[model samples]
Target: MLARDESDLKRTPLHALHLARGGKMVPFAGYEMPVQYPAGVLKEHLHTRSHAGLFDVSHMGQIALRPKSGKVSDAALALERLVPQDILGVAPGRQRYAQFTNADGGILDDLMVANFGDHLFLVVNAACKAEDEAHLRKHLSDACDIDSLADRALIALQGPKAESALAKICADAPSMKFMDAGPRRVAGFDCFVSRSGYTGEDGFEISVPAEHAEALVTQLLDNPDVLPIGLGARDSLRLEAGLCLYGHDIDTTTTPVEAALEWSVQKSRRKGGARTGGFPGAEKILDQFERGAPRRRVGLKAQGRAPVREGAALFADADTGEAIGKVTSGGFGPSLNAPVAMGYLPTALSGIGTTVFAEVRGQRLPLAVAATPFVPNTYKR
Candidate 1:
């Protein structure tokens, strides 16, 4: 269900509404999503930077896990055994960022895990949800029940003005803080709202029943600051925020250590030696922690206007042309107003001021390994 030949793309619950709003529909992760609305990608990007923008992320997978004994703590512990993140510490109405790993220590997918009252709520990548569910079912005990929220729709309202705009729609909005989750009525529909987002901004992700999604989105859009955004802008925004995409930036080939995501590995998971080593490739991951990884992901800034897309060859030295790594993601950053990218390179060549070359259109362009988040993120703490 990847974005390949799009002869048959899956439509989301708001597909018709997107078309009505003049969204340029495109195939992404098997879903026919709007890449931009009538406002255009650039406008939508800037608007989201300064105002609130509504995004239809229903294509993402939403799932719930419950303990058969009605003990939520036990369910979280069972999940902690699978992933490196400290799920057991997640408070009710709070969310934690986590990843699913393979036996080789490679990341299968990075996801959000929320303690939604008596049940655990998860929002996983649409492309990897099926595999994630299978893994959870295989690893979890029989007392845990896994349920997919396929009939649910998810939307993100992000940017500086997101809170103020969304507050007008839900009376209980102000009480929620970063990474918090709570149930509330949105547009007359019972919904789960989370104060976390991928765009590196203060935002909320609202999950509602599929049948009531369109109306909920329409009601939010009624506010002047809330505009409909699409996948194109979302990609640029996340990249600018120094976030990684699932298959490209982090994948089965790259471990969390090499991906520069050691922060996501909780401190408790790193303690007790082998006790925290049950996950995939635990030995290798532990070794990398003791000694740094060989290659590491870093941010790249090209010197020219020509943006180097993914797959651009990265070199160890400018004239050597010897491949050190490859660009995982690259594009024009609307916020930074320049070409920005992220990729991996040998540890020696990954320093902040290290110079490299990116092969773009048969010519090597000057590139420097620079600090990420080309633009500062305005996340609410």
Candidate 2:
């Protein structure tokens, strides 16, 4: 692990605790997050799949967006106007994944929005928090309050054993369904717990007060089944699960439909027609929906042991050398034990089993458009 000066990188609330546990900190999203522990990224990736792995994701922005007029429905409608998800139908204690879109229907960022009784809670990417918060405040009416919860720390306990591990600390842990959230008392501290994660595993993301983060994390890690994980493994895990990283797979230039995330657009939006199509790039998105995007995101598999990284140019024909697309996210999938990648190619060449070529260091490598989730996702529902 490469160790840089702790002063240069921002630290989460549990930064000291991570160092104490032999965590190797690295710069990620401007924070000194652990990319791996003493066990290494490979082991951490495997541990999170087979057992429970605790991850400190405190850098992620947590914000509360209360309706301007103190009316929850108004806030939901306002948010639904911007995102593709059905936020208006979100029942109390339930959360929905949504995308922040630009005028062109390109994704600005992906976030989780939860309806917490009277208020709405949002979990946004750490890297895009500033832009996201500013956008939310500027667009929302004064009746709504957009407040950041910087005093809180976020932690994810991911894997099939997440419930058992968390149950050791909180009694009602097992009853929570996927995407369900609630406030709970753990070790005499009030914390908000959600049954959700990014690794495509059954898990929970716990939001604890910064002052209490250390003790709460300690209690969870004390369980024999729980190990500490880091960002490197988190990337590999999401890759195997076919989930997109904000700046990688999905970006400002990639529309949700082109990225094959049309499911994120709720049925109401599709049915409302012109009335609901008031969001940024709505015309283009609706047109794409009516017609179709010229290019589509697809998964790729290298035909050799060498792992392909992002920026590899994709070719239209193996022998023609015609450039068609480029690799977005690529890595050695720990779960699949092979090299897997994702990229966007011309619609005609995006079919499954289509042979493609990738230019790696001037060497033409054979590739193929394969079905994603290279490894079957084990998400709990």
Candidate 3:
């Protein structure tokens, strides 16, 4: 693939801050983003595991769904038409993870939906934001007001000490629990704060106005415990946390069940539930929930010191014969001090501790089917 021109890439609200802090900018999701800072990926990854790490995720898409009927339930029900998740069950001040599945049960995109009383807030992947917005407008424009938040900037403060660092500026930060979300004055900026993050850690995702985003992030970074983190650390953190990266661990070709994301689908959307089988690909997805997907996503732990990377073919035996599966995401888990990978495997061979061989370089490396969140999550539930 040809590299995107840096001049043509979009810049986040904190682009200047990243440059000032010696961040190595790279093209990602049509945006000029910082992949790492002067601290380096390893240190950044470890720091986030131990202390608080601030991330500028402004390139992500923020959207609002306001019900024309003035009832949030109406908007939720409208959204349920697109996602298989029980959006109506997400109470006000709370959020839930969901996916936009296609007619063939493939995931269009995975997103976060938060109920904020009168309206619903959505955060979609940066790369798929345009398509996601178009989808919402095509299907839900009649029931709700689809507004794309183009002037907002999103940032994440994540880790064990994230709450303490955020609490210094936003007093209500300490009161919020996991998945709790609402509007708050964060460092004198009118921002939306959610106690949820991609990293399996206790953290907050804050959305502020574009103009004030830099100032707010600067304030948060001023805290002694908070450090500016980049995409390199963010990827490792989420991978170790067993969280899926939209285009990598999952994509339009992968379904929720096949990706090991059945938990995100509430019972209300399943067969025999109150409201069932109305979303796209309901038949195929629901069927998978009842029976099982042909293949399942599982954690892979490399037996040797060398790291197993993505696109590596997996085989049942050491001698590569027919490739049964492929690694979707893989790399060194700095927190684990070892190599961790995730991939798909046939249902019969996806059991925990089942051995599989990943073809890396010219040699086949032995890998074990391991339970995920290789590192335990620290969400303050």
Candidate 4:
């Protein structure tokens, strides 16, 4: 849900930095977040593609998982009980994307988990933090200690010059590959830098203590290559990257398989494998693998100028009357120079070249089911 009123909205550690830079603030996920700056969304989106861009994502939930028995694998295994992921298999310093699923095979939230040698670190959506913390404590308390990292702030440096820009401040940052994470001393501040980002670019997500956030952000922004970006550009960049926004692309009523994220669930968690049927909705999820879901998420390219926004109903172009599916996330791809979107359609009409219609403002606009990544992903491996 979007934040609406600033009077009661919470503020992040970087809230002042955004305001100082003339950010147009908006309520988002219970916080006064920056949706855009004076440069505007279009320029901000393009700047991040050409140069490095810094984003303040401190509103997200950061969690630390510690095992009482002092065993890393034990903590990892405990996490596997709630989500349909092979958390125990995550190697030290590596991370994986996972989702907390419901008994009906629906997703509660999606997150990233990193193995930090002695403990596990998780980054979850801002709106789902409380629920996620409760879920972890309810099921994993016996094996591990769960706590929120409320004293930290996170920033992302993204785009083509991300590595070089980061390397200038932190010598070890450039060495990390995709999904790799560990501690590093950057500008004399102890921080956790993960070579991962949301823009489908080669970049890093840095986690630093709250006290050091401002200094770190100031240092990165001084690099000339890095400009401060806001939420509007963040959404557009992620959309072009074809990444899923939790509430829009996935939710409690959507399963991982239905959302086309089966790859994130390793083979070990599937039926006939070790620890099968152990997680929430294991049976339903595995069954969907053999017998696919009736409706599936797919990428859509609008044939007209109007954007097919979320909740817009999809219909068969030829049938004209019966609705087949609905758009979950839709917008104009600044990089693609055209309108791009993602939606769910029945398998019969979900083929890559299938034609469909979006009922936007009473006009049934034509849309085509196309492969995702409306813009090519350039993540460094």
Better of 2 and 4 by lDDT: 4
C-alpha root-mean-square deviation, candidate 3: 0.9
Q: Please write out the lDDT profile of model 3 over residues 1-381, one tens digit for every residue.
A: 113677788899999999999999999899999999999999999999899999999999999999999999999999999999999999999999999989999999999999999999999999999999999999999999999999999999999999999999999999999999999999988999999998898999999999999899888888889999999999999999989998888988888999999999999999999999899999999999999999999999999998999899999999848999999999999999999999999989999999999998889999999999999998899
RMSD, every candidate, angstroms: 1.6, 2.2, 0.9, 1.1
- Stretches > 4 Å off in candidate 2: 1-8, 271-275
Q: lDDT for model 3, please.
A: 0.94
| Candidate 4 structure quality by residue, lDDT tens digits, 1-381 | 665556889899998899999999999999999999899899889999999889999999999999989999999888898889999999999999999999999999999999999999999999999999999999999999998999999999999999998898899987789999877888889999898989988899999999999999998889888889999999989988888999999999999988999889898888877877688888899999889998899999998888889999999964457888999999888888899899999987889988899998887889999998888888878
Overall lDDT per candidate, in order of appearance: 0.88, 0.87, 0.94, 0.91
TM-score of each: 0.96, 0.95, 0.99, 0.98
Expressed as tens digits, the lDDT of each residue in 166-258 for candidate 1 is 888787777788888867887678999998898887899999999999988888888888899999999999998999999999999899999
lDDT of 2: 0.87
**Candidate 4: segments with Cα more than 4 A from true spot:** 2-4
Question: Worst 10-residue stretch by lDDT in candidate 3?
Answer: 1-10
What is the TM-score of candidate 4?
0.98
Candidates 2 and 4, the one with greater TM-score: 4
User: Which sequence of candidate numbers ranks them by lDDT, best first?
Assistant: 3, 4, 1, 2
lDDT of 3 at 258: 95
Prediction 3 TM-score vs. true: 0.99
